[model samples]
Target chain A: MSADLSIVRGKQTLGQRILGFFSRSVVNIILIVVAIFWLIPSVGLFLSSLRTVGDSSSSGWWTIFLEPTRITLENYANLLSNPTITGSFWNTIVIAVPTTILVVLIGSLAGYAFAWMEFPGRDWLLIAVIVLLAVPIQVALIPLAQMFGAIGIFGSVLGVILFHIAFGLPFAIFLMRNFFMQIPSELLEAARLDGASDLRIFFTVVLPLGLPAVASLAIFQFLWTWNDMLVALLFSNSQSQPLTVAIQSQLRQFGANIDVLSTGAFISMIIPLIVFFAFQRYFVQALLAGSQR
Target chain B: MTQTVVTPAARETGRGDADRLSRRSRRRAILIALAFLAPALVILGALVVYPIVYTLVRSLFDASGSTFVGPENYIEMFRRESTFTAIRNNVIWVIVAPVACTVLGLVFAVLMDKIRWSTAFKLIIFMPMAISMLAAGVIFRMMFQESPQLGVVNAGVVAVHDIFVDEAAYPGANIRPDSGFAKISGAIVSDDAVNDGSTVDVPLIGIRADSLPDDVVNAQTAAPARAGEITGTVWLDFVRGGGGVNGVIDSSEAGLEGIRVEAVDNAGNVVASATTDAEGRYTITDLEPGEYVIALPPSNFDQGYQGVSWLGEAFITGVIILSYVWIWAGFAMIMIASGLSAIDRSLQEAARMDGANEWQVFRRITAPLLSPVIVVVFVTLIINVLKIFDLVYVIPPGVSKPAANVIAVEMWTVSFGGGNDQGLGSALALLLLLLVLPSMIINVRRFREERSR
Candidate 1:
């Protein structure tokens, strides 16, 4: 009887194992299918960019497998030779780099003050920062356009950068201050006891400890400025338009110029994609930390 | 060393010196902090705070900022049909996009654990987060083209359609002039009724010779009709060399196969029907000895399966919203997955060991535990969608732009997209701010709660 019971128990375990395997495979299949679905749009764009103009217009991008010779670098070559697209590529760097650096410098100082220093109405100012975090960029667009016009910087790269800095600060300061608060007060007091000035303490102690947050913020701000189109559309002129505005202008009314559009769009996308992958850890960290708070 | 014996006056004097020194240091510290914060404060005060106040003031004034409108722009914004359409589209976006992204994200996050290649899957889904809204707009715009040859979406739709439904053989075929037939309501009908045992011919024009289906054979003349039967031939009337006579089925002309021919009586009922063969000859036999109309139905001339017009006015907003959801669902997934990782595993294991299946454990344990994160994702998405502009701006064609308009686009259009009505634009901007304010408040409150903990 005991032997019979053992055999039955073994059979039951085997059946459960098979059931588990089946369910697990189902989950994997679902996830894989979903991932492919997510990838099709971008993949389609990439393939379309590689095909010659005549070929892409006549058939879907997926047909390249049937005629592999149809793919070529001609579109990329044409895109590079186009002065407008290349100029806008340069314009993107001109706008994004300064915007990132200025936001970080100014935001770190303000965040340090808010976190470590004792000043009048500190809490009220921090509350103001929090409130500003929720304010959309549209509220600032009309008035700033006027302000930039009055200052004679309208439709210039400088105007776009300044706008980005102003809007990027509140969230930057909030994020940095929160990160800075986690640093023990003892460290700052130690530096102070050694006759370090407030500036020296901030530079040596606070900034070093806040590297993760700073890195995250830098990546976040860089991508934000690089990917921005609406601000550039409203504020920048044809002479100063970034790759996004340039691409938008090229989008024809009927029958898209697939060659110019696909190539230019891919060009605009490649840099951010590289930056994102290289520092994806920090990017994801920033996203997770930003949302949790 | 000198002996120390302090008088009360000396001690009090020392205390005063120390107090004065500390007060001066306090003053200096305030100045230093101000110095650190000055640039950020100036920019924020000028750009964010001041602009908000300026927009409010501008909304109350005329477009040129010289005359006081006093809420006239607001009233005008409400009265405009475009404004109502924009508001309605925004409501649809808020209702649809966020829920779609969040639910898909949750399901993806939960199922990812079951796969060995979960990281690869996550990366693929998260890849779009790096793409700019403008690039995504361009990608989707091309993907949703109306023609199957140009758009992958339509290509797939057309392929699937062809599988279940027979395509029309001749889309643009029509009757030759004076061919004893006239197009009535898109059908080729005989101009005069014919009795049984008579022969009829429908020689069609308008189809190019090169465009004809490859299997088409040379037209064959129908044999003389037997008693109580009607016979006919439907073939391309025009010859390739341009020497064939009008309304006559020449020997060289190719037959238009699969064209349906019906014998209709006076009451318009289809009495008998036949489909043309490769030689374009169809015959109806055993008909009563009475007059009947030989007609070709409209199905024979249908432009077969043009696929969906995805960029048309009806589907424009939906396509744009689908693109938005595509870009954002990964963000939601990553966030919720992080929250999922933080939950205690033993609770889930305990539920599983207690005879619950995966769905039960998910519904009873995982979903309930993940609610806080889910709510955060949902509200964040709500805030994001309210100001959505790029996809709406780029994906729609010029004709469908009005249908896909949201409040943000409306604001831009009124002020900058050639309308030049800044007063009304400011009002629209303020309206958007008000719509987004509630979700932002919820997010800020959640931040505060998280911080206090």
Candidate 2:
């Protein structure tokens, strides 16, 4: 990539050219080294999962290249059959899917309300949601858990999903509201002018335009729920533990199990990876969504 | 012509407003908003607000789990030497981790700009972040595991010694058989005393122990561990041994006559922990350690009894800031970088034409312009960090370290872990809310400012 750089100057002086050449080479080398440094641990993890237990235990993962003939898939095979891990993976999906759907669903509706609906105390409600944004999840866990217990959702996947949705909605609504508000008032005015209801204007003109924000929200909420363990652990019973909780349980009291732990970690990574890649563009926007200009 | 068009238009608009039921509709809109917002508001209020209030109330109580001893708990918490240690450690964690991560992340992002495989690199660094905190804890535990070189890190150490140290000196390089953090020299003895002044036999556990030849074991005699020489890093070895598959060589086996385990909470005050079982496992409950969450009670009517657990509620208060920072800083950095990159090339060119140097151009032109982005980043980071949870809960084991803990994890521990002290948890949670609510206010003000602009 550095080799394809566009030169800064059309006609460079002698000293300038010399400095540029040295600077570029040094910068390129540093960048390459950094990229490798940043990536090595995760790559090492991937490779460790792929290799046989014996190989992983004996040498540094870097040493595997020297003994290319020793690679095996036994660890992955064992991971697949591991009942706890597989169940957790399934549980994670059940939790993440619903949580994402609800956050997006409720958030968009609330977004619509804040954007178009001319209600008294509308600004106050939006502020309240914004205020609610800072209610640390930790603070809510106990009471929320107790609430779930009373409602018969404690130790259930639904309970976990509901908790995630509740926490996720404030930010989700903020994101979606901003996006919806960006639509020119004239557009909605036009729709209403043609005898369309507010609901129809929302479903037709606004939602289509809010796709970018919605897509980003879905990606974030999905990843957040998918990766969440604290809520799941607190809310879900052992039978319904998410992949993170399950993976944590697989952590042997003594030390990490290379075979099981790596496989479990990789399994957890699969969905997040898929989500990120599938919505790569949205990922960028979502990363910057909540910040002010 | 103008009057005819204007009069009809006015009437039509008024008719439209009346048909839509302006006054009645306004009331209806309020009702609809209340209905729509009721679920989230009620839930947040119940779960978040109540617990924080409960925790504050509970912190005033005596350890017997009853009695309101106003400011006594806080006084006692501060009086303990260990409390000071915990506070220091937490301060270190807060100062070190975030700043380090942010700076490192910024540097990486800058270097990664326009690089090949930048996305791939980012995923790898971020991979640790995606894994559960509990999982990361376990992974680090494994890496730091001590054994007969059974843990990856120790194994590497042993390998390095095998290559560098003479074979005679490397008798049992893999096995750090001593308990605590010290090495004691004695003859390896089986069943009784071996007064040998030279070789010591330590029956090492873990895989590395398996490699020790029987001859070495027979030749070596066990020795008493020397005092005063044990160091902190060596203590890490003992801690590592405690968790690894390889059992730590018991202090008794080393002929240490008496050993007592004294545990301290983050406040550094000694707290009673459950005695270790025959298998050496100890479970400590009500250890107000680590991060926690604070929330209101589940239902509005039940707010009479706020919920707060000592450890659970308190931990939540500590972590609220940290978790928020981790989540929002990524965007802050990205936006900050983008804003920097977006400056017009012509501006820099114009500066250069005026004989200004690059540094001056950046300081004068770039930074001032980027102020808006920086302010945005700061506000966003403050709000986000205030709400942080998972990272705090997942990183530290609250049982051993309390002071270093955050509010979120503490709340969880207090609420769910054996301490069902919901009232105190609620109080602490409310404290967290107090900290976080200001950010929301700032955000709203900013939103209004932008809208007006």
lDDT of the candidates, in the order given: 0.87, 0.57
Identify the leading candidate in terms of lDDT. 1
Candidate 2 wrongly placed segments (more than 4 Å): A1-8, A52-58, A291-293, B1-21, B25-87, B109-332, B378-404, B418-420
Q: What lDDT does candidate 2 reach at residue B322?
A: 37
On TM-score, the candidate that comes out on top is: 1
Tens digit per residue, CA lDDT, model 1, B1-453: 112333467457778556556766887899999999999999999889999999999999888778998999999997998999999999999999999999999989988977889888888888888889999999999899998988889988988987787544576778888767899998999999999999998988888665566667898988888987888888888877689888777778887778889999888788999888889888988788889999999988776787999999999999999999899999999999999999998788778768898889999999999999889888778878988999998999898999999999999999998889999999999998888788767766776787699
lDDT of 2 by residue, A23-107 (tens): 6677668867755644543565677777766665665556678888877888878878978878888898889998898888778
TM-score of candidate 1 relative to the true fold:
0.87
Tell me how far candidate 1 lies from the true structure as C-alpha RMSD in angstroms: 6.2
lDDT (0-100) at residue A213 of candidate 2? 91
Give the clash total for candidate 2.
97
